[model samples]
Target: MDTLTSTSANTWPIISNIIGWTYFLSWSCSFYPQTILNFKRKSVQGLSIDFLYYNVFGFLCYSIFNLAFFFSEDVQDEYRRRHQDSDNLVRANDVLFAVHAFLISFLTLSQTFIFKSDQKLSVTAKTFLLTFIVFILTAIGAVFTEYIKWIDVLYFLSYIKLLISFIKYIPQLWMNYRRKSTIGWSIHNILLDLSGGILSVAQLVLDAAISGDWSGITGDPVKFGLGFVAIVFDLLFMSQHYIFYRERYDFYLAVDDSERQALLPTEQS
Candidate 1:
């Protein structure tokens, strides 16, 4: 029994690391699908600009959180002591993922400006102004936190990121519902996001189980909750794409065919 328990304990971190890397890879690639879809379609129609707006800000907060955690001596020391590793608990890929997310979201936002779309889902001028103001305020806050050496602001930024993550999908989900179709959104992106979210939660679970440290599970409730919520949203998106949109598309096709038949005799005469 002792040998079995020892082996499981030894194997868990390796499994956790594997899951972490899988999540990193999934997250890294997730944004590309939307970018590519937008480029190929040459339009941001049916895509919510508000989603991109919130996403860029969310990624910005997440990036700050990762950078602050990675650089904090206190955080590094604690992680090293607990894990008996020289490296901090926060992985370099976390920072990289955050950076990539911001960049990709920015790219998607650029598409909203550059591409012409008749879709009403696009952000309004008033919303753009509001977003600009928010950005400026956030920048000022960041500067203030840095100059004052208010390190606890890092936690605030992390919580903001979590809040943004929780709400960011809402606009997109609502837009899809209003449109009754997921026409312009990329299912590939949602699938990748789901994979990443599941892997992230799995890593946390494995780590907690292996270390027999339940506190580790609750230590970062934001991270855990974000993963779970993201997965739920991703699944909702998949259902919208596969089930709801499919039905809507078929209905539209039938209506179009009927209209065409009705016009046939008029055109013939």
Candidate 2:
């Protein structure tokens, strides 16, 4: 069993590598367009805030978890005689770190431009901003992690931010579930999120099992568990969309038109 455990840890790199890139490609190619469309429309009119907020939070937590895993390893290696610079785990971490950095960049960029008006930024311009923010932040975080004693606090902030962000979504979830419609939901986004959540939990469990650390496997299981539960809810949310996908109704970009129609029924009717 011990050998098996060690072998599993050794194999984690390959598994994680495959899973991580799969998510990256899927999100980049499939889900990103929906967000871009929503931006063009300037209405999250049919998009679910609960889902988006939860995802942002989840990414933050995952980022922190990744950082902690690295920190713990650095501590462990410090006690050894001569540390090998090219360990498999180190290489895996590097890959994961880059992946997460990209995730954060894309997300933040999406948030910034996806909610903005068309006049504000061209598609190419938004892409540039996303790339810039992602690069700058990833570089800064990497540097800080290596040189600063207080950097662990940044990881702590990431965890806390996730929790707060997740909590902010509860009301939105309840309201949407009660209404039985995704009046403000984006199906593709939620679908991708559900996939991401499953991958995240799987990665966490694999890491925990390999390391023999139940705590690390489950980061603040209460918070983590809630996030997982939220992901499941997201799946259900997407189901709601699937059941109603063929229904045709206008999702407006603004409320002004609706209000005007109400006030002057004779003008158009």
**Clash count in backbone of candidate 1:** 0
The reply for model 2, stretches above 4 Å from the true place, is 1-12, 24-34, 40-42, 46-152, 174-180, 218-230, 243-246, 253-269
**lDDT, candidate 1, residue 259?**
78
In candidate 1, where is summed lDDT lowest over 10 consecutive residues? Answer: 246-255
1-72 in candidate 2: lDDT tens per residue?
Answer: 322355466687578667655654444443565556565666654444444544454455456554554556
Residues 119-198 of candidate 1: C-alpha lDDT, one tens digit per residue = 44345534643664575467558767675233345555666677778777887898788767786788899999999999
Best of the candidates, lDDT: 1
The TM-score between candidate 2 and the true structure equals: 0.53
